[model samples]
Target: MRIIKKLGNAFEFFKGTIAINLAVSILPLLFGGLLLFNYSVVSFGFAISLAVKEINSKKEYLFYFNNGLSKGALWFYSWCFNFILLISGIFIFNLINRLF
Candidate 1:
C-alpha cells in the first residue's frame, strides 16, 4: 500500500511527461542509439522532464513534501516509475516485433 501511494505520487509527474518521454525513448532507436546504449537514453529524457517540471512548478512539490514525501523520496519514486515504464515499453515493442 505504501509503495502504491508512492507510485501514485510519482504518477503525477509521469502522466504529464509520458508522451514526451516515449518520443524521446523512440528517438534513440531512430538513430540506432538503442543498439549501442541499450535504452539508457531514456534516462536523459527523464532527467530533462524532471528538470522542466521542477522549474515550472516548484510549488507543486510542496503538497508532496508536506505529505511525507521528501524531495529525494519523490525523485526516487519518479526514477523508479520511469525505469518501469522504459522496461515495459521495450518489452512490448519487442513482443510486437516478434508478432509481426
Candidate 2:
C-alpha cells in the first residue's frame, strides 16, 4: 500500500511537470507570433523579457519557464525560416531582373 501511494504521488508530480512545460512553451509562441505578424519588435522584446524575468524569479516556476522557452525557440525558428525564405525570394528576383 505504501509503495502504491508513492507511485501515485510520483505520477502526479510527473503529470504536473508535463503540464507546466507545455503551458510555458505555448504562451510565448502565441504572443510572439502575434507580435511577429504585426512587426512589433518592441512588443516582442517586452514579451520575451517578461518571460525571462518570470523564469529567473521563481525556481518552482522552472517547469513553466522551460515550456515558455520552448515556445519562444519555436517562434524564433519560425521567424528565421521566414527570413530565409524572404532572402531567397529576393535573390531570385534580383537574378531574374538582372538576366532579363
Candidate 3:
C-alpha cells in the first residue's frame, strides 16, 4: 500500500516526462552503454535535473517542494518509477522476440 502511494505520488509528478525518460533510458541500450549497465543511474540523474528544469515551470517545482517532498526524494521516486517501466519493457520485448 505504501509503495503504491509512493508510486502514485511520483507518477503524478512525472506523468508528463514518461516519454522523455524512456527515450533517455533506452539510449544506454542503443549506444552500447549497456555494457556497463548504468541505465537506471543515468536516468535517475537525468530525471533530477530534467524534472526540475525541463518538465515544467518554476511554480510547479515549488509546488512539489512545498508539498513535503524534498527535491531529491521526488526525483528518486520518479527515477524508480520510470526504471521499473523500462525494465518491464525490456522483459516484454525479449519475451516477444523469443515467442516469434
Best by lDDT: 1
Better of 1 and 2 by lDDT: 1
Candidate 3 per-residue C-alpha lDDT over 40-96 given as tens digits, one digit per residue, 9 for 90 to 100:
434553565475454455556576666666667777776676667657767997899
Global lDDT of model 1: 0.71
Candidate 2 least-lDDT 10 residues = 34-43
User: Best by TM-score, which number?
Assistant: 1
Residue pairs in candidate 3 whose N, alpha carbon or C atoms collide under 3 angstroms: none
Best-to-worst ranking by lDDT: 1, 3, 2
Cα-based lDDT for every prediction: 0.71, 0.44, 0.62
Model 3: worst 10 consecutive residues (lDDT sum):
35-44
- Pitting candidate 1 against candidate 3, the one with the higher lDDT is 1
Which of candidates 1 and 2 is the stronger one according to TM-score? 1
